[model samples]
Target: MPMAADDIETLIRTAIPDAQITITDLAGDGDHYAAHVVAESFRGLPRVRQHQAVYAALGGRMGGVLHALQLTTAVPKE
Candidate 1:
């Protein structure tokens, strides 16, 4: 089954309530997506750690049902 964009957004929002997220369907399939996320929670985190947090929000579905996720995480601009 393919993952929904809204669902992905919701998951991230649930994990980081103040996040601003943009989810794009990379392959025109729900399994492949690119997410650009800005959140207060990512504020001092390393790039890898920030990415990890986003992936963890998906409940380990990265290589399973979710497939590919090109993720970019940033702290909210001052």
Candidate 2:
């Protein structure tokens, strides 16, 4: 099954409550998405780790229910 944009945002917010997230449907299909997430929790974490954290929030839905995701993660500006 494809994942909804709101569903994606909800999952991320659940894991990182303080997250400022922007989710976009890349193909007009629920299967493809792009998310830009910013949170204080990502501070000091490496870029790869930041992306990992977002993936973890999805609970292994990446390649299954949810197909492609172009993700960008960042810490809030100080």
Clashing pairs in 2: none
Segments of candidate 2 deviating more than 4 angstroms: none
All candidates' lDDT scores?
0.91, 0.95
Specify the highest-TM-score model's number.
2
Residue range 3-60, candidate 1, lDDT tens digits? 9999999998898888899999999978999999998888888999989888889998
C-alpha TM-score for every candidate: 0.94, 0.96
Worst 10 residues of 2 by lDDT: 69-78
Clashes per candidate (backbone, < 3 Å):
0, 0
lDDT by residue for model 2 (1-78), tens: 788999999999999999999999999989999999999999989999999999999999999999999999988887
Give residue 20's lDDT in candidate 1 (0 to 100).
93
Reference-based lDDT, residue 63, model 1: 94
